[model samples]
Target: MRFVRESGLYPDVPVPEVYAWNTTFENPARAPYVLMEFIKGKAFNLVVRDDDPGLLSGLCAVPESQQVALVKAMARLKASLSKPVPFTEIGSLVVDSSGTFSVGPLMAIYGVSLGSPYKSIEDFWRASHEQRLLEKIPNFCARTEESFQPSERFTPHDLMDRYQKLSALIPYFKIPEPYTPLVLHHPDLALRNIFFDEESLLSDDPKVACVIDWSGAQILPLMLASCIRIFRGHRYTGIVVIK
Candidate 1:
């Protein structure tokens, strides 16, 4: 959020102030930790009733007006960040000794291992599927073979074959030159991660005070980053992108 704050795009929106942080396990905290500002605001989910059944009508418990305001606020944030920051490669953001920001090695899964920074979208996509086929599938198969029924368990060969097929289709999914620039993408932008003033729900325009939990954010191609994510009952329906 240092990046967002420095951009000067969201004057009304405020990210937490980091008092201190240790990114290493050697710290007294015993694990990596950040001491940040505690903003007083309600999460987006808190504005609605838990038992409300409005979702069945294709609307969430939030009133239609509030929903519109929420979308507007979030869209502005998304658009603002999408512009100011642009990277040549796809990777996690990193700060160097001189406090200069750059794209760094990507954490494929919970930082289990850092993959080389990808200079192109094709490289990133290819490495992702290759890793899944070569490592993830084999690891999963070995871990689950003893507990799961044979019919239910996926063989490493079968899973790898499926991944290989998906990998082969990468060319067809390529974005044109216009939308290929790398932009930051928040891996999780659920309502729970968005905060606003409770009183703002009564107004026609509710401002998002903060957006938290940006752990796995990455710089991705605009065609992938600009995709809209729909929220179903309690889960995200994944990103939907239009050419």
Candidate 2:
């Protein structure tokens, strides 16, 4: 929220000001609670349906000038939100007692068993692959093992072959090298999180009122930073014949 405010990417938008917070979970009565400024505006999702084709049909329904302005504003926000990572590590950002920012494990913030942060993207990939194969697969198999016949069991060789195939794709996808620049990405950019002034939406100059829900934002490789869910409507045409 501070980053968005400081960037001034959306001048018309208003981010709620946090007045206080309590993270103590030892007592049920003292559980975490965040007191923030109340923002009044309808969610953008109310106007645009997620299943709408081209993701532009709703916008196109408005005046041509408003449509153009909204598109331009969205593009500018995307560019402004992306920033280069200062460190070479792949992890969540943390501020130490000395008041210095540094990279730390995702577990610190999410409290999951994701383990520590990696020094390189390759390390992150390797650890993630291992975790999925070793931990997730086994846990899933255990729950459904009784339903499968003995011959249908997933053998060690099966897992190895799958791992090898995924490993080979690393180079094909062109995963970034160590110390490569990363950008802070909001994985979920659904329309519901965006707020706009309804009056201005159809005016000559459309203005975004605010964008909320910054949870799970992380600095990651540019290749993985693209908003996949939001860009699903965009299509690329190409053909590659692999002999």
Candidate 3:
């Protein structure tokens, strides 16, 4: 209320004014909710699906221009903040509005990022010889194994012991560095979620009118965000870089 109202976002009145928190207290009491202006526009998914080609359509092909814009948008979204929102707040973790099942649904119980290699998520992971970051990773892995069924926890020291024991039996067994801290990933930048404008190539509203449903958003690193682009649907081409 204070920021949007006081902040000069519009002329005298914003498009849809935030009246009385989120609701009106005319006669009956109302529940509290945040309010913002509503702008009429097509969902980016519809425009992107028809405009050119979306990342959603794998192998179908989208223009490099559109793809670039999507990346830029992702970059902006990813770079906009410094602190990481709770995993639940990130858009990717939310239930999909389109009835599309999310990878998050499966991993939500584990408190592990899906990008966490399957091995790291496995039961009884070898600590030292298998892990790249030796010590820093063990505690993190152990944290997950504590409650995760079918998985064994390994502290850094435990991992080292496991690695030493496994060295004699396995060939080239190495768990890579943690992907969590390495990259800022927008894990759920899907095509169905983006909107575009006529003037803007892929983005009809280049100014980021309003980013709806951010349950899947993550803040790992640029590489992770870009790599997730690989999994985007045909309609999505990552952020489309117009300017």
Question: For every model in order, what is the number of clashing pairs?
Answer: 0, 1, 43
Candidate 2 deviant stretches above 4 angstroms: 6-14, 26-29, 47-73, 95-100, 107-113, 136-154, 168-173, 176-179, 202-205, 231-243
Tens digit of lDDT per residue, candidate 3, span 114-198?
3332222231133323445443574466565445544555455576676666765544443344433222243444444444334
lDDT of each: 0.68, 0.59, 0.40
Q: Model 3, poorest ten-residue lDDT window?
A: 116-125
To one decimal, what is the Cα RMSD in angstroms of model 2 from the true structure?
Answer: 7.3
Q: Using Cα atoms with residue i matched to residue i, what is each candidate's TM-score against the true structure? A: 0.74, 0.66, 0.36
Q: Give the TM-score of candidate 1.
A: 0.74
Error of 2 at 236 (Å): 11
Better of 1 and 3 by lDDT: 1
Better of 1 and 2 by lDDT: 1
Residue 213, candidate 3: Cα error in Å is: 1.3
- Whichever of 1 and 2 has more TM-score, that candidate is 1
- The clash number for model 2 is 1
Q: lDDT value for candidate 3? A: 0.40
**Candidate 3 local lDDT, residue 131:** 42
